[model samples]
Target: MRRLLLVTCSALGLLALLPVNGALAVELPVRKAGLWEMKVLSGGSVPEMTMQQCTDETTDKDMSTAMSPVAKEICSKQDIQKTATGYVTDSVCGVAGMTIKSKAEINGDFNSAYTVKTSSHTEGGMGGAPRDSSSTIEAKWIGACKSDQKPGDIMMPGGMKMNINDMQKLKALIPKQPAK
Candidate 1:
């Protein structure tokens, strides 16, 4: 359960990371307010996952406001540059005693659809050995959220819907591990 929460938190961190250069932090453009479906593809131990998110501008901005400070505190290097193809971000951050160096290229406009390809190498981390991974995240605007859903609500895999802001509720969703 702890591991799952850690993974969740890490994923949230990645979603909001932006370039920080000597206090000149550039805010990433907010996604269109509504429902967005995201599919993550990877060849690592983790399998492909899909989720839908209901978001508003303020919720998205709040995530950035809440996370950037933590990123700046732990990351010695974080850079982003605009490219002809799209935008590219490079970062080196430490979490849970592991150092992660990554480069990601983002393509497509956020209003409709977008793709982000990321490659990273991790050292001295959870597995206790160096590891490399690559992943692609494709997301698209999926219309409005159901009346029952609220902003920051994410329909995670397995059809569990939880608000990103109420993280404590996530503990109930993670399955327990067997006795080792």
Candidate 2:
């Protein structure tokens, strides 16, 4: 369950680049319709993680729909801006009792390859420890989906795979926060 959570969040965060303004709908340019290979380098302690996603236009839309409500509920500020290079996103949200402030810059072409560089600060979480962190997401088109893979399929580390569309079921498993 934890692995799936990590995989899900990582994939969504990477794809959506942490979203901005659910009301406005952070509609990122639909990536080329095909398999995408993504390499993520996050923080210092965790080793680099690589994953593959079979994606399509509809799948990207579905991801935005799925994550928007949660973003709306937890995020106080989410904004995206067009830059000369590409896109820049800034967001602040509360998650699992932590308040996170993040800024990300995206560069490169979506149809071929792209890079997102992000820096963030987190405080007042379950551990009550504050920290600053950054991550780099580098992704490129691979090809069509594999024979065994389908849209929304994410091949995680160690060859484990999960369908993002199926992850809605796990919402019930998350413990809800008590009233403030």
Candidate 3:
């Protein structure tokens, strides 16, 4: 469930980067340097959880695309429009024979707080059944990072800390595979 929310948040992060003019270019509002708390609620099927992250300017920007390994690989095209309240996006993407059509509406000031509501439908999913889901995420600034926490450090729901930027280090932690 947590992983699902994280992935949803990743999509929202991409949405946040949309230009105010509705351009596809990534232009994210600068969130203040501090600790942030995000609460995610995805359908009744998943439990709600609040996760905190510490960020600085660089970290905040990097986080926007952390989960987006390849935009073109996933989304064929994404259309974003600025709404009176926040922004809206209509996206289409496909992977592994699964096609996803999604729409998202975001509200609130990204500098301090914001909420994203999203609904998506997937066809040809793992179970070969059409899947429809909706999720809401609320995030707000929560003062400074803790003494032990630094920029780019994310504290997952299970109390595990990770620096996503240090992929090499994480890879090092995994034992190498033996030759066939």
Candidate 4:
């Protein structure tokens, strides 16, 4: 009878461990390559020149000129949250800011997560000119082993451009295994 009880308890313990092992076995899907779009909604004045000024200015002919102070200020003040969603197949996957190196797969049907980084440097303005500055921003999607493709060209709304290969590499570092 004691032997029977011991065997039963051992069986129960192994049965309990099965679910745990199954849970640990879950694999994350891979990311793929495709087109991704993102938008920034900011609070502040929209930069625009009056019609009269446009007619008078000969040097500044482009409508999409450099960002004005008000525009910059607004962009700085507003919180920026970017959400990326798209499809992935064996041939292609599309996400904003990164090139799909390889196709993403649905390992266990969980959505991937991402991280973003941004930096800017501004030179103090001189002689009433707007401060000279530039910014570099990168966004990385983290989770699972997906695409082998590195992040590549990113397109902004109204046709802006950025490079995000490095960021994608960083995101690729996310471990495929779950914690024990």
Candidate 5:
């Protein structure tokens, strides 16, 4: 379950890299400021998980790190191409003994709805059990947030509610780099 979550989160981060302009700038495509729901389907191993997220331009910018600063140390290659309708990206990333090569496509409108599909191949990990998987995520705007839900808040799977910023702690869990 945790592995799935990590992959899902990383995929979303990569999708967020879709450029708002042709220069492949740092800005993510703009979406309305409100509550949005994302339903993720991962090869049927994990049941669909629907989570609501509060979004605004600033929040989106903060969450959308196609590649985190530290991630650069691990990801050796990245290529992104803008298309008439959406964007396509391919990247190679490594973490410890695992390395992954992935490609993704995003289509539809960011303001109202969009779909993201990603496929990846993982080598040198998971007991050598041929690691390959695909996932689809559909996100739609859902108007105002619940009264109790604040911006940057997300209701994750397992009925767990957490502020998106809290996810930063996961960065700490990454193994430290050996002496440079």
Candidate 6:
């Protein structure tokens, strides 16, 4: 009877050591606000300018000779404008014939939503030479942050969506061991 009781107690202790599989609990980290900024700079060549002028020295000659250079000068400015447009267009998207500088800021509540403010400046070239513009966008997250019980993963939500693939990719990006 004593041996039987000892065996039964040992078995119960071993069973207690075994992990319980159902409904494992995990602790999730609190999300916080983050900020990022991006800037773009671009430039192009200047166009030549032509102006008509009267010349007293050449007054004896036909007035047409003096007037010819002035006409060419005026037309050259137009060609410069066209060339600058072509260069700027090739360099940046949706932004042409001007140099653009922009700034953006975001204030985020990791749990719920975020607000963004952006502003831009453009300059150089003819016809409405320099201008500045600003815009804003607001966004929200769909769900609360959560953790996974699996060996190598954490689950989280971003901007009104739960991206399982992103979570997996993020898991891969994290190093298993710290660098020396």
Instruction: Return the lDDT, model 1, position 44.
Output: 42
Best by TM-score: 2
Considering every candidate listed, which one attains the maximal lDDT?
Answer: 2
Candidate 2: give the clashing pairs: none
Q: For residues 2-108, what per-residue lDDT tens digits would candidate 4 score against the true structure?
A: 33332322222211211111223221223323332222211233221110010112211111122122122212121222123422212111112111112221122
Pairwise lDDT winner, candidates 1 and 5: 1
lDDT of 3 by residue, 1-180 (tens): 558645554543444333333336534466788898878778865777677878888876565454343343356557777788777877776655566777888788866898878787878745699978777879999899999998877787778787646633433433332222
Candidate 2 lDDT, tens digit per residue, 1-180?
645544544643553454543455444688888899999888766678898989999987787667666566566777888788899888776667777788889998889899988887879866699878788889999889899989999998998888978766654544454445
TM-score of every prediction relative to native? 0.80, 0.85, 0.75, 0.20, 0.79, 0.25
- lDDT by residue (40-155, candidate 5, tens digit) is 77785566767788878877766645335545555555667778878787766665556677787888788888888888887875556558878787989989888888877988
Q: After superposition, how far is residue 28 of candidate 2 from its true place, in Å?
A: 1.4
Judged by lDDT against the true structure, how good is candidate 4? 0.23
Ranking by lDDT: 2, 1, 5, 3, 6, 4
What value does the lDDT take at residue 160 in candidate 6? Answer: 27
Error of 6 at 104 (Å): 2.0
- List ranges where model 1 is wrong by over 4 Å: 1-16, 19-25, 167-180
Angstrom error of the Cα, residue 52, model 6: value is 56
Residues forming the 10-long window of minimal summed lDDT in candidate 2: 18-27
List candidate 3 segments past 4 Å from native.
1-26, 65-69, 166-180
**Model 4, residue 83: what's the lDDT?**
27
Where model 2 places Cα greater than 4 Å from the true spot, the runs are 1-12, 15-22, 173-180
Candidates, ranked, TM-score:
2, 1, 5, 3, 6, 4
What C-alpha lDDT do the candidate models reach, one value each? Answer: 0.71, 0.74, 0.66, 0.23, 0.67, 0.28
- List runs of model 6 lying over 4 Å from the truth: 1-95, 124-128, 143-180
